[model samples]
Target: MSKLSIKPLADRVVVEPAAAEEKTAFGIIIPDTAKEKPQKGIIVAVGNGKKDEPLTVQVGDTVLYGKYSGTEIAIEGKDYLIMRESDIFAVL
Candidate 1:
């Protein structure tokens, strides 16, 4: 698959989550109904360093996002996310 190569501006980031069919710590196969939306994602694209504020992160950073963070986008057949920097809860 092709990857996107655009950087967002101040207070924005792009993210992709791990797949949903992943196994549990105890080797349990989580049913779809038993799974919650994953809040963990890796930053694929980052903003232009947040407009004069020192950039807290960069591309390839893993982050914890809000439950309802970001708008979804599909670029070149791959999925991505766009959201405010504030929407990111923490860097992991």
Candidate 2:
């Protein structure tokens, strides 16, 4: 699928979440209810920083965020998150 065309606004960022783990190291399959929420993702779009506060992240940067930070969105059947730059904890 093609990338999302939407652009974020000030202090906001768009992220494509990592896939949920499907199996354990021991070869046990994880049911959907047992899967953990992904906390890391690739930045797809970033807003121009807030006045006097330039954003530290850029597109394509992989980052870690809060468990329930961003709003979930679906673009062209692909899921993504949109959150404030402050919501991102670190770049990986």
Candidate 3:
């Protein structure tokens, strides 16, 4: 992966979202209009925790989050999401 130029502040994290699924479990092709928003992503950047609390997730960690958790952004023509650490659920 290329180095990112953006940094998040205070407990916020920047994520690279997984691409939307293009096929169903049964091998059926899904149209773009029917593809659901991805709820999983990889942590690419992290912020220092507030004072005493340390961040549990780190760069390169794959995690799950709310379907609508973060704000979408484009960095160097690539898409990403920036959200608070709380929005992330579990590390996979």
Candidate 4:
């Protein structure tokens, strides 16, 4: 699959969440568990940045996210998150 390098405008970020492991706490390895998506991700693509404003983050940065922040997107078989820069809770 071909990857796109389109950058978002304003306060937006492109995140590709890491997949969660497929195992229960009891080590049962439930199918559902394996299918669940991970909450954490690395910053793959970033926006052009705040227009005429300063930003504290950049591409390749890992960040903490709110449970309900961002829009989910699937591109070329990969999952990604598109959220407002302000939605980012913290950078790790």
Which candidate ranks first by lDDT, i.e. highest?
3
For residues 9-49, write the lDDT of model 3, one tens digit per residue: 98999999877666534343434465453377789999998
Clashing pairs in 1: 11-85
lDDT of 2 by residue, 1-92 (tens): 25568989899999998766565333434245654533777899888989999899988887878778999998888889999999988887
Give the Cα lDDT of each candidate: 0.71, 0.81, 0.82, 0.68
State the weakest 10-residue window (summed lDDT) of model 3. 23-32
Identify the runs in model 2 with alpha carbons over 4 angstroms from their true place. 1-3, 22-38
Per-residue CA lDDT of model 4 for 1-92, tens digit only, reads 23466676677888876556465333433233444332556777777667687567777776767656798987777778898878777766
Using TM-score as the measure, the top candidate is: 3
Question: Which pairs of residues have clashing backbones in candidate 4?
Answer: 22-34
- Give me candidate 1's TM-score against the actual structure: 0.71
lDDT ranking from best candidate downward: 3, 2, 1, 4
> Which TM-score value belongs to model 2?
0.77
Q: How close is candidate 3 to the true structure, as a TM-score?
A: 0.79
TM-score of each: 0.71, 0.77, 0.79, 0.69
For model 4, the local distance difference test gives: 0.68
Model 3 scores a C-alpha lDDT of 0.82
- Taking every candidate in turn, the Cα RMSD to the unseen true structure, in Å, is 4.3, 5.2, 4.8, 6.5
Write down the TM-score for model 4: 0.69
